[model samples]
Target: MSLSLRPARRDDAALILAFVRELADYEKLRHEVEAELADIERDLFGSNPRVFCDIAEWDGAPAGFALWFYNYSTFRGRHGIFLEDIFVRPAFRSRGIATALMRALAQRCVTEKLGRFEWNVLDWNAPAIRFYRSVGAIPLDAWTTQRVDGEALERLAAG
Candidate 1:
């Protein structure tokens, strides 16, 4: 199967949203999909866009995508790329699509001299964990990921 990767465009909002919902469904958190295409379109294509994405095509059809953003690394004293999401459709799994998508990001890091590439994986997702390890990523077991959301986040911001 022929596969191609390219930067996402404003016209891809609907496809991206569909892939995101597929991801949420796979993770059994479909209810958490509160985002709309309008929000994605604005955030991805606005004058001061907050994030960026790349799309993967398998045999000229949308097969997967990777959304990412740049972040500052105080320790490295340089910026890094944080992969927010990477998903390959079930029919396209094990066909090297995910690897190609990640390589696109890694190549960007090397070409741009980004400090690092970082992302989080669910603890229970063994297949993804194994795939990540095969690609030279080490598990950051020493660090715990944290977040503030919904009401607590709002209250904290107000205080």
Candidate 2:
């Protein structure tokens, strides 16, 4: 299928947003997607970008993307790549596109001497979990993820 991966460009913001919506819909979290094209552009293509995205193309067409950012691990005393999202269109699944994306990220970790490469998957996503496990990803089962967003996040910032 001639798949290739490349760093996303500023012109790809709309496509990336479309992929985000598709992924949210698949995960049944469409209602929670508050991201807009402007946000994507500013965050990913600004003068000092905090996030980055890699696009996967199959036969010169958009197939998927992986969005990530650097995160610090105080215990490890180094930076790691925190994968914010990885999504492949349904028609492109099971074609090693996702694996290729992950492999590229792992390569980055190795080259950059990063302490870890990690991401979270929903508990109910058995297929995704299986794919991750097959790729030698270990689950941090003991760690429960917690987040404060929306009004709570604003309140915390105000304090």
TM-score to true structure, per model: 0.97, 0.96
lDDT (tens digit, per residue) of candidate 2 on 1-159:
699999999999999999999999989999999999999999999999999999999999999999999999999999999999999998888999999999999999999999999999999999989999978999998999999998999999999
Encode model 1's per-residue lDDT on 1-159: one tens digit a residue: 799999999999999999999998887889989999999999998888979999999889999999999998999988999999999999999999999989999999999999999999988889989999888999888999989999999999999
For model 2, the superposed segments whose C-alpha errors exceed 4 Å read none
Clash pairs for candidate 1: none
Candidate 2, overall lDDT? 0.96
Candidate 1 wrongly placed segments (more than 4 Å): none
TM-score of 1: 0.97
How many angstroms is residue 122 displaced in model 2 relative to the true structure, after the best TM-score fit? 0.8
